[model samples]
Target: MYPDIPIRDWTFENVSGGTTGEPVKFRHSGKFFETDQGAKLLFDEWSGRKIGDYQIRLWGSERDIVSGKKDWMNKIYRWMRNEVFLNTFVMSEDVIKKYINVINETKPKMILAYVQSIMEIVKYANLNHIEMYSPRGIMTSAGTLDEQMLEEIQKVFKCPVFNRYGSREMGDMACSCNKNEGLHINTFVSYIEVLDGNYESCNLDEEGQLIVSLLSDYSMPIIRYAIGDRGALSSKTCTCGRGLPMLKCVTGRIIDFFKTMDGRIVYGDYFTHLFYPCTNVKQFQVIQDAIDHILVKLVFFDKDVDNKGFYFEKENEIKKAMGEGTKVDFKIVDDIPVSKSGKRIYTICQI
Candidate 1:
């Protein structure tokens, strides 16, 4: 899936999210990181933070934390870069409290984290009326941030919350400027296109699959690579006045598509939208176990809150979308596990 560059010439190997299926590895040249720095520089300039600023990263899982502790070279590298790493996979009350204490003590200038991970922290802090350290800025990636999530995060952090769009295959493809209008494409590192089902370019503000061509990865030329997520290109220029183009929004992963019995495709966002108005649901995951069967696992904030009628209505909606023959089952669980990369896979198709 890449160029004929020798393995010895590659500088880094990264894996895909593997949320829908098996993860694929991609190799990068030395210049890849050099050009990736351009995105960081842009973000720093936009957010009023520098490269050497003290930053805390809420990322990875418990296993990653254990392995990271043994990697002394990495520790030294992070120290030199003025960075701290905190495990965000498990957000138990104790773990959240520990993270809160560390952030207060370290007082990092910036906090970088996955949208869901930081939202968990925000939820905990808000519930306990806990005071959090006010960082200069917060950067969120890996997951989408709805309006509610963004507002809560800003309220708690009292800092600009910047949303970044990217993948392991492509480094920082785009990021929101201080204006927070939309994500500005990292034109220095990538060229982006939003194409419809016909493999033709989508009009401005038209939602379609995003294809990216990496400008700096000469070792493995990834051209017009479909990154699987759906989004749209924007015609409106950002108020920040950056010449870089903008993406209106990233809808969801293309792999989230579920095939119905009659050969129709149901986007996973359909299931996610069902839970949007459900305030009692703390977390949820939808899985297409087979062509005609869907399993919904949910964690509720209040177990005693009876939502049988709500569940039945949602089941009917799912059946309407996936075909009436489709079997929709709901399961209540204590928690849902995050992916190895510490991201919540909201939907999965096991076909």
Candidate 2:
């Protein structure tokens, strides 16, 4: 779709997990990386960390791991950047214990992770009475960070938790400053707007759809892009005195935890990651009907395609995380409906 941007200029190619629809493959130019790095620098400054500080990133990508690139790439990157990666794909008790051990060994100055993933770690740590190395700050992204989750994370880690809001299509757009009042938009690289049903801008503090334009991505300019999120802009200035604009709150991405019969809690994003490579599926929803039952609703691009084999293959993996006795049912549907708020939530826990 982006034919104007030359292939040589595309430095990074990635596929989003498609929380709302089918997976999307997008390319980023070298300039996009520069702006992304700049945004991280701003986050560091706001979080009271300096550049080149040691940090551990709790992130995971099934594609990277399957392609066998994450192992060597992470090793080299860790050596050059003073960073470490602990995959959050599987959150079993053993994995969480390993994560804690890595943190205590590395003693990173900052811990950056997906909100739900780190929340799982904190929950496990608290329950098991496991002590962790306190970092200077914690940065959360990729999921909704509510007030309760934020407070719990701060109490467990004994550090300020900064919530970051962004997407794969657009690099880091807004992040909470040290003031913790709200997330300040990276006005230098992007413009943000909150719109109502009429597609007009909403008043300050009025909840609406978030529309963003990447000012720095000229190669594949994204203008007035409806970013599939609901948020509001703040009217008050931050006490830290940064002139950047702020988001009063982001309330669009809501993912629930899936529980196993054995009392294990799995992050909702794990199921989303499971279907990232299923390009034939147009959209999907995972619903935990009971502790040992899961119902998956799928809308495929071609309704006539045989999907039984796909279902059986993924069913085993789901059961592995949810319990061996778990019953996973896959139903092909004509459409997966959105919520009353016009958002397509990929994961839901009815229990």
Candidate 3:
């Protein structure tokens, strides 16, 4: 820590990759935002959202919009871009009603949101018979977006949903194009390398830890830093004709993997893929309390629906994947809490 460096000298305030572990705070060159903005403009343009296009961002906190008088600068920025910022902290019926009203009226071109937050909005609209405004496309980040969740979001919004991948420390790394073949790497800002346990390049689609080198950060040089996530790079190119490289998948954090009693390591996606076909389930989380005991927390669309049979099936399914020695307990909840960074960690390992 450089205690002698004045706080004013450091330009950007950024937090470390804490989706899987503890968070660390750091400062960087003031020019970092400019570089990120340039990268984002390109990413958004690829998805049909131009710089001047009206957009809605579902990313601000309640304090940011509590009173227009309190944050005059944000209000002016919103006005200039014709954007709306929905609060993720409060999604009560009253709050959602206000969001629906504003969205229907503005009719923005794009809706950028955290995956789970947007899913919750769409779920509420479906459950309460609330009408939604149609945007050119929806872009989601900050959490994992499985196939089932993607289908539900697109079905409710009636628009193409693009998945964006990145972190606070790495800025915009990859995003899906119109083709949706896979996420294209932002080779302009960062150099990404995928390596196996032996630290060798994985062939084609083999899963490995993502080591990123930030080319833009000169004030605080970061080279081949493990951002604490698992993914794979595609040897194939995109069909959309973009020369940008592709990523096969960005599964959840590597630390979330659970070790079974039999010493088998199970990744988080193994549990995520299981609930993909369950339309009745809104969201779920898995916590490995011990080697032989697992706790499953679930949020359903309909609270009254009979999940007894479904639980029985899931028990057997989980047992098969995690080994029959593990016992799983299911608990239905109203909501799943997010981390301090406003992202959801679907899998929690107590071991």
Q: Evaluated with lDDT, which candidate comes out highest?
A: 1
For model 3, residues 315-335, the per-residue Cα lDDT tens digits are: 998898789888899999987
lDDT, each prediction: 0.82, 0.78, 0.80
Q: Report the alpha-carbon TM-score of model 2 versus the true structure.
A: 0.70
Q: How does residue 6 of candidate 3 score in lDDT? A: 40
Cα deviation of 38, candidate 1, in Å? 3.0
- How far does residue 152 in candidate 3 sit from its true spot (Å)? 2.6
For model 1, the stretches where C-alpha displacement exceeds 4 angstroms are 1-8, 61-70, 257-280, 290-293, 301-327, 349-351
lDDT: worst 10-residue window of model 1: 60-69
RMSD of each: 3.9, 12.3, 4.3
Expressed as tens digits, the lDDT of each residue in 228-286 for candidate 2 is: 67789999888888877889988754335677888776767677767744657656789
The stretch of ten residues in a row with the least summed lDDT in candidate 2 is 336-345
lDDT tens string, model 1, 29-60? 88888888677767766766787899998985
In model 2, the runs with Cα more than 4 Å from the true position are 1-8, 63-75, 254-351
Reference-based lDDT, residue 3, model 2: 41
